[model samples]
Target: MVNITVPQNSPSSSSHYKSSPEGLPSPSPPATIKPSGSGLVKDYWIRSTTCTASSTADPKRKRQLKVDIPVVSYGHSGWLTSSSLTTVVEDPWKEVEVDGDGFSVYCKKGARDVMEDRFKSFVDFNGQHKQAFFGVFDGHGGSKAAEFAAENLYKNILTEVEKMGEVNIIKAIKQGYMNTDSQFLDLNNRGGSCCLTAIIRDRNLVVSNAGDCRAVVSNGGTAMPLTSDHRPSRQDEKQRIESLGGYVDYSRGVPRVLGLLAVSRGIGDQSLKQWITAEPESNFFKIVPEFEFLIMASDGLWDKVSNQEAIDLARSFCVGNDKLQPALACKKLVELSVSRGSVDDASVMIVQLGQFC
Candidate 1:
């Protein structure tokens, strides 16, 4: 028997609606029997030979680009399941650790063959001091949506800000999200990304989230969650999807939309566009002395680590030190999540709020 455990609502998290349990239809599994776990050496040999022969047969096709980064075997392993075999190949382009002017970021791939998580940070955006944009995007299905958003979401937001000015920051942000979503759909890309973004301008803090990615701020040693996870299990989100002619399914361990996508809101997912919206929940705050630092991460870390637990650990690494080491702190959080059995790609960023204040 499979006992699926869902994340409990946190005190710092807010939801406008309550959930009522009900039965739902489960989708039929694929008829193909996928290879499970590490397979027989013979099977790998057969597949390799077949691929080599096929490539040789089609010599006119362009060769795939070869990456030259050295592979580190440590912490990277392949796992096997009853229905499929998963491998983890280290990506050299991914930012394992980075230290910016006032922020630090860390990322690590999980058991998946490709790391679907992406992040972006721009300090002194638009050539202005104390103005910045930070984001963590968790991609599902593929990395295209995540990559596109990481590169263009802030740009779109900046464009909107330029048109609307400071007074309409919230409206500008909402428009920015919709514009990004529409632009991505126009590209005819598949998959989707859940994202959390924080913008600092004129000493004011604006935070937004469209999926499970989260933003938490440390206020005088207390952990404050600024964004709520937009899962299908969430009452308001489930109801919203149903009202729009979408149904939430409970099969496959967790509540999912049509038993396919897990999150109810995201940037792309053109196929599920009708059911999934890119509307992000946003909040505003005035930077104050009480606010110490901010933490933004994908659901990968949140799935295994609690907001308070992460904040407590970060405080030990970032606060009261002769020199700040937020990059190391971010790494530690990702490591902690992995140790706690998180198999999802984790990306974490820590921003020192006091610097902006």
Candidate 2:
């Protein structure tokens, strides 16, 4: 009989998910067959070609002629079954505010998600500046890179702005980006990249794009791109890549470098570190009250969904619900992207007036 003993801490110990009853008897093993008498006798006999009459007469050879045979037995056992109960903890979403912009930011990391691509609304500088800043740092590679930008970019911008003053917001933005990149390189040994777009003092929207992630601004019910998507196919990007000793190849009529990655700009990627540097091209826009909303999303959502589709969806939710919040609208966009078969990590942030407070 086969006797199987399970440890107390085994998976089957859980009463809720276990299949077997308590203290059940083990199952029996398969029976083995014994050889017949003649076959067993033949198995012990030895036959050798070199045996001679003179050798047979030797006492040692005669004494050792009786061979001892060993019998081995084996049996089969049934399969063992077990069960386990797993407990998963869900993360919570929270709302954060940025002073008096009448805007509130709500952020949540979704199911099986690791990256957080949210932002804090701009804070005033020494209580003297009237500018309200808001930004979305879309991260690629990992959340650490994005988190690094989201936490430090604004502070870096503020510091650069203090030295350069209002005359050089673009320059300051660039300098701040470089500073942040250097800091990331120092801390992580590798850095992550981000697409940064900030609304400063509620009057200017400054954007710095590095990767394929995008920032779009909705104006008067029309979608307008606030920043260009930095892809490897772009002429300037291709030239920059090759200039930095990287090669671009055409595979199956599609232009690709190393036949895999698509983006032109990113942090880390130390393998392509020569091609990647932290010099950001800054574009500044004068914000008017006419600006309806700003939508920022990772490539996962943008790759599968159109800009207009996202805008329409967000607008629909905003118009239908009298008290619709922009952050909630952003969440809805993420949900829609998932429903549309976007298997990649998806994140979206929407900024609109009157709903942020």
Candidate 3:
């Protein structure tokens, strides 16, 4: 194996990308850094820098390759913290939560030096008092893909609905995912993101997911999953990849696409576009009294907490004649996930269905 040195940046360094007058931040540094390794080393750090190859085996003889590290500055409150209405410094080891009317969101960074998870919550969407949207994006490789999706996905859906007039809500959502993926690809960005989104319009609830992020609703305290994770371990996904000339390797104790990414479908990931997809699995349900609340979260929680256990705990804090602190429920869940040895970023949002139903 070729040894490579990665330049590390402090967390506070993200502040260097402050927003410009156009509401977009300055571009990231060009990828003209020194070349350090062999062919494999060139591919490992493709996200932030480019590498050049030499026919000789000498590292000193390799020519340096230059590229641009795609900058995702729009709609970012910071590198780690995200809130639709307000900004808060995010701390993985401490409570970082946001409370809104009938909804609350909590996000905690993982063991990684940088948090890659981003979320969105929009209420009174497009002048419609009853319309709302919520989403959670779990990013891997880099945060650019997740931040891009969180900023543009729902807006794309809204644009489609305005043109199509909601003739088919599901169709609009699908288009949104497609547009977001295509646009991010044009940026030539590395990495990808798993997304879970919930859209509430009138008395209808539409849920969609492209990766491991999940959505669960409580029907009278019963947990009902809305999306199935897209992993290579699934028989159908494995078959699909094999049919497309790709293979899943389980040698690392997790099924990965070509022994790389564990997720089979996500936004961005241009290198693995042939094997993975951005197409989301979507479902619809009519809001009813039986539906008590909805939970949208990243795999950080699911890796350690069972669905029923999460539901039961959330119910204790929220389900009653007089609801307790829904925000507290969100905090408790994230705390539990971290306490259970989850070193991944945990983000959870609790939406009380009674307000919409």
Candidate 4:
């Protein structure tokens, strides 16, 4: 364990970081806002200072779907797993139930590859929020970044949410991403990880993405993309990079920041922090009755499968006595991608929205 303790911060904690004039833009309330205090949301308490208020903020694969963006080419000489003299532990691919009843999850580490992916799904997590919290972190270079993110991202987001007392989902989620990136940078961790998280509360489905890992929702069997993959080749992404005086290099079919990291936004990669950002693009929508299911996975699955195809396979499993076994459907998705030659760690979390009361 990397001793995942919450780093203490004071409102005037200059020692924590040398201030930047652009010192992380203050987080803005999510695009859509609903007045707080609905019967569905339970009030939660948070210490006033657990998280300092400062800024707000806040892929894949395969084939050539309508989106022509290239999948990451696996060449990471520029990045290292960990600089410490310790051997990184490898986790095997096995389906485990992290949460149940309201949701089902299935996750596996890639074969022969130190599992760089981590996931979480909790209904009424930590006795607060009284809603489902889910996420998938895809790590490159090492599992440290992914592990760290899995351990802390939710806490940070919740802290922000608690600060707002569930007043704003978007800002809380955005600050969560920013806080995770800042905390990781304090360790000067050399690797980076992509993040995709979905917070379901008040009948609202809010999703935020910081890299290529993805979140998709099935509305009446129609596949709807919830977050945009943050890749350098996207015209807007390239513009953002160039504007920051950071350029993207395409020596490989994929674009890399400074010819190094593949994704345009992520949790760490301190070296490319200036060019790449940890801020996320989030989408918030009222979960309609048509919302049947949601699938979030690392690029390993996304690279070889299309959004609609993945949803179709999931729907196929919704038959017979196994109708509620979404975890099995998740494992099947991973198997299908590996069969198709996915070359990275595969992880998937399936949320049967209809199952939620």
Best by TM-score: 1
For residues 156-177, write the lDDT of model 3, one tens digit per residue: 9888887777868788888889
Question: What's every prediction's RMSD, in angstroms?
Answer: 13.1, 28.9, 15.1, 17.4
Error of 1 at 268 (Å): 0.8
lDDT of 1: 0.70
- Candidate 1 per-residue lDDT over residues 124-210, each given as its tens digit: 666576778888888776667787888688879888988999789889888999999999999987678898899998878999989
* Candidate 3 to native Cα RMSD, angstroms: 15.1
Clash count list over all predictions: 1, 9, 0, 8
For every model shown, what is its TM-score relative to the native structure? 0.76, 0.64, 0.75, 0.72
| Residue 137 error, candidate 4, Å | 0.3
- For model 2, residues 1-357, the per-residue Cα lDDT tens digits are 111121111111001101211121232121112223332213322110000010012376443232212222111121122221121112111112111233323333433234334454443433434545555655444455666776676678778988999788888878887787778777744335555555445465666666655666666666666766565566887898888788666544445444434555655444455666667766777666556777766665576567777777777655446665565566677667667655455556565543321
Poorest stretch of ten by lDDT in candidate 1 = 47-56
Candidate 3: pairs in clash: none
Top-down lDDT ranking: 1, 3, 4, 2
Pairs in steric clash, model 4:
26-55, 26-56, 27-55, 27-56, 58-280, 59-229, 61-303, 62-303
Between prediction 1 and prediction 4, which has the larger TM-score? 1
Rank all candidate structures by their TM-score, best first, as comma-separated numbers: 1, 3, 4, 2
- Candidate 1 Cα misplacement greater than 4 A, ranges: 1-90, 93-95
Q: Model 2: residues >4 Å from true position, as ranges?
A: 1-113, 116-118, 123-130, 249-260, 319-321, 353-357
Q: Model 3: runs farther than 4 Å from truth? A: 1-95, 321-323
As a whole number from 0 to 100, the lDDT of residue 154 in candidate 2 is 62
